[model samples]
Target: MALAYFVLGDADRGRANLRDYYLAIGPDHADQIARSAGTHTVALKETIESFAAIGADELILLPGLDDVNEVDRLAEAVL
Candidate 1:
């Protein structure tokens, strides 16, 4: 969505794109996430793996990060 804003120069479209994919985390899902947070280091690793498995391209994830190196790493893939 951020990429949409950047490329199209349309804030509304970017917001619309974001809204299209937005999932409202209800009580049950939130509770499950909270329960999962109580575990050790591997919990985070597993969660990230699951997220990765859900399939997002580099461009979609780029604008959300703060690291220049990671941005550089994924930028080429987007291009």
Candidate 2:
């Protein structure tokens, strides 16, 4: 399992496997799975303040953020 692999300290491989699996199943299935799990799935295309206003407790920059200064500022503001 992906989570099992992650917990076993192979996060890169685990995440890759999970991503591949998700892609294979496609968005509709992924959305269904997310709904069944009681999660509100969303794309991270909005500003940090907007996300915060929508009750986001934490933010993960990932591919959307690259500026170190901005990242630090957001981290400080959020955390």
Which numbered prediction scores highest in lDDT against the true structure? 2
Q: List, residue by residue over 1-79, the lDDT tens digit for candidate 2.
A: 0111111123244344445556667977644433222111122223444657777776544321223444344344335
Q: After superposing candidate 1, which stretches have Cα over 4 Å from the reference?
A: 1-30, 57-79
Clashes of 1: 0
**TM-score list, all predictions:** 0.30, 0.27
**Largest TM-score belongs to which candidate?**
1
lDDT of each: 0.35, 0.36
Against the true structure, candidate 2 has what lDDT? 0.36
Per-candidate alpha-carbon RMSD to the true structure? 11.7, 11.4
Per-candidate total of colliding backbone pairs: 0, 0
Error of 1 at 25 (Å): 9.3
lDDT of 1 by residue, 1-79 (tens): 1121121223244334333434365555543333333122343344445556666332234222233553444344333
